[model samples]
Target: MKSTMANLWHLVKGVQIRDLGEKRYLFKFFHIIDMERVINGAPWTFNNHLLILHKLKGGEDPL
Candidate 1:
C-alpha cells in the first residue's frame, strides 16, 4: 500500500489509509478533487490486487 501511495503521491497532496477492519480501508485525501480523479481513473492495480476507491459525502480530517 505504501508503494502504491508513493506512486500516486504527486497527484495527491495528502492521504491517510486506515484499516476499517476486515479487508476494507478508508482513504482520506486532502482534496476531494484529487479523490475524484482517483475514483474516475482508478482501480490502480499493483501486484494482482485492484486499488478500489469509493466516494462519500464526508471523511476529511487532517491526519
Candidate 2:
C-alpha cells in the first residue's frame, strides 16, 4: 500500500504510511505543498476501496 501510494502521489519530498489499526492509515508528508496537493485532490481510492483522509495534529491519535 505504501509503495503504491508513493508512486501515485509522486511527491518531491515523499511521504510515510503507517498502519493505525482497524483499516486506518497515517500519511505523513515531508512537505507542506505535497500534503496540500494530496488533500486538495481528495477522494482517493485503492482497489475500488474508498480512502478517507484526515489531517492530524501534533501528538494526536489518528484512530
Candidate 3:
C-alpha cells in the first residue's frame, strides 16, 4: 500500500504512509507543497476502494 501510494503521488519531496491500524493510514509528506498537492487532488483510491485523506493539525489526534 505504501509503495503504491508513493508511486501514485509522484511527489517531488516524497511521502510516507504509516499503517495506523483498522485500515487507517498517516501520510507524511516531506514538503508542504507535495502535501498540498495531494490534498487538492483528493478522492484517491486503491484496489477499487476509496482512499480518504485528512489533514490533522498540530496536537490533533488521528484516531
Best by TM-score: 3
Off by over 4 Å in 2: none
lDDT of 2 by residue, 1-63 (tens): 988988998898999888878988889899999999999998899989998888888898777
Ten residues in sequence with the least summed lDDT for candidate 1: 54-63
**Residue lDDT tens for model 1, 1-63:** 755775765555667778777677777778867777778776687577777665665565322
Inter-residue clash pairs, candidate 1: none
Local distance difference test, per candidate? 0.69, 0.89, 0.89
User: Considering only N, C-alpha and C atoms within 3 Å, which residue pairs clash in candidate 3?
Assistant: none
Candidate 2 TM-score over all chains jointly? 0.88
Better model by lDDT, 1 or 3? 3
Backbone clash numbers for all candidates listed: 0, 0, 0
Q: What's each prediction's TM-score?
A: 0.68, 0.88, 0.90
Model 2, residue pairs in steric clash: none
Query: Model 3, 23-61: lDDT tens per residue?
Result: 898988999999999899988999999988889999999
